[model samples]
Target: MNATVVYELAGSYFGGTSSRPVPAKLVVADDRLRVIAGDDLLAGPLPLAEIVVSSRLGNTPRMLRFADGASFETAGNATVDRLLAGQGRRHGLVHRLESSLRYVLVGLLVTIAFVWGGVRYGIPALAEATAFALPEAASRQIGEGVLELLDDDLLFPSELTAEEQARLRQRFVPMIAASGLPIRLEFRKAARELGANAFALPSGTVVFTDQLVKLAEHDEELLGVLAHEIGHIDRRHGLRQVLQSSALGLLTMTVTGDVSSVSSLIAAIPAILTQLGYSRDFEYEADDFAAELMANHRIDAAQLGTMLMRLEDALRKCPEVERCADPERGWTTYLSTHPPTTERLQRLTKR
Candidate 1:
């Protein structure tokens, strides 16, 4: 049943077909019906007419009265279904877009979880394994690097009088021995260059800056500082940090025999040092251990606290003395990397 379609909306009757009734829903979609007939599939030329028409089925019929007294009926149910299918397709597209966004959000959450878990647990285990597998040659290279860095500032050449030097040995040696670590202490007299910094090497070597000795108001201060550095060795903090930072480099070189990336990372060593503040918990643990060492040896923990207080005060007053020795801007290095002074003091005083 092929037919031409015509439209009549209001008082205008458009040329249309009677063979196929134009769908009411399509007509509603576009009301430009002066040319469209109810049966017009091909939107070709059709003469428009003036008419008032109405529908037959529903009470609200599409009514249009033609000038020539003719009329066209409204479209049937099948055309309404076609309009509904078009709407469904649009809704389906929106659903797919929403689904894609959900997947992206889920992927980001998974990535975050994996990274957080890896850092909290996997890194330490990986470092422990790497430490066992590390070769002597590699260890020596690391040791040499540490020694080179410390050599520039370690040892006080001429500042301590002979009696003062002997007294430093007596105070430090017994205290270190009391701490129960298999570590040795050596003093040097390069007083001019290495005044205020101390370090521990990977190969069990501890270097004390001559300036650090000079800054100490008493032996407890020096002992406190040295014990903290020894704690780093005992807990393997230094080894773990180094392994974690170099994990990618080590793994890449191990698998691919590439060294450039590792070398580049090594070259940025100073920047790494500047940023290597210990975790707060690690600092507190070290302080607690040092306090225990002092208590075990019958040395007063308050003396250590007093030493810190004096150092803090002296820093406030004669900043230039420490500043001239070390290039550090202030106590940011000690304060940020260590526990709060008040908290450490409280712990020392606790029964």
Candidate 2:
């Protein structure tokens, strides 16, 4: 059984201004909307084609717009529902998004989750995959560029007696070379402004600071540090770190037909290393590599753990505030990226 839906008319005063409820009844049928006021037929048997319908999901009134920009409203929505049901076209992806509180909230939550996941997981995985696929020459270029930055601001020629440097290199080189990895061992004197820190470049260059060499109580301890840095190069961790830092910009360029120079990626490495520390897993993996290298060479792996502890103390005493945690001296660990020394020590000494 079909019932006629009659909506009250709030007709405009003086034909087109403010509205006042008139004594009128609006009758809606399958094809048209009709209205009668004081025995006068007001406006149409108007076709649904020239009418636009909009409504909320609940009890709120629906508004209709006529071709001439005049409008009408109905309370209780039942009449609007019937009229919309017969209209050949519908609108309210816009209407539902704006008017339905539940759907709007759900959409907002889903969008946030998607963006968070992309940043946390998707971007890193893509950056790693892309980084690993790059040519070895490109990586070396990146390493050289980073070394250039370090040389410019943080490092100078090593002051170690050549005889001492040659002796250590001769022993360390043969041991590391046996692993079938190509690595260049270079020594430098870190400016007093920096502390004892050793990092591998993507080009397979493992730079040793004279301070780090002097900090090592045993040659084995220095070898342990060298092995750890070799692990970084062997796994291409340096290049990956560089790639990950500038991923969004690099990815944007790749997609937009503006692939630029690898030099730009290299230039950013100094900031990335100083400010953003490597991921914890990379640190652990490098630690594992050093341990394995020590075991293979008949050297005690505990030497690495002992050296890590001392390195922590050395960094603590450093004058650079960005690399240490000294509240009285304005140094904070905010820029420190290395995994906690206690954790690395425990892992290295486990066996």
**Which candidate number maximizes lDDT?**
2
lDDT of 2 by residue, 1-351 (tens): 988644443432112343654545566666676666767875577886677767455666666666655556666365566556666455467666866789889988997688556646676677678877888887888876778788888999889999999999887976677668778888998877766778788888888998888999899999889889888887788777776667655544544443355765565444344325446667888899888988999888889988988887787777677556742232234344667677787888785
Question: Candidate 1 residues 299-347, lDDT tens each?
Answer: 7767767766655554455436643332234555454555556667787
Task: Give Cα-based local distance difference scores for all models.
Answer: 0.54, 0.72
Residue 36's lDDT within candidate 1 is 50
- What ranges in model 1 sit over 4 Å off? 1-99, 128-141, 153-158, 188-195, 248-281, 318-335, 346-351
- The C-alpha TM-scores of every prediction are 0.52, 0.65
Question: Candidate 2 local accuracy as lDDT?
Answer: 0.72
- The residue ranges of model 2 lying beyond 4 angstroms of the native Cα positions read 1-88, 92-98, 248-278, 319-335
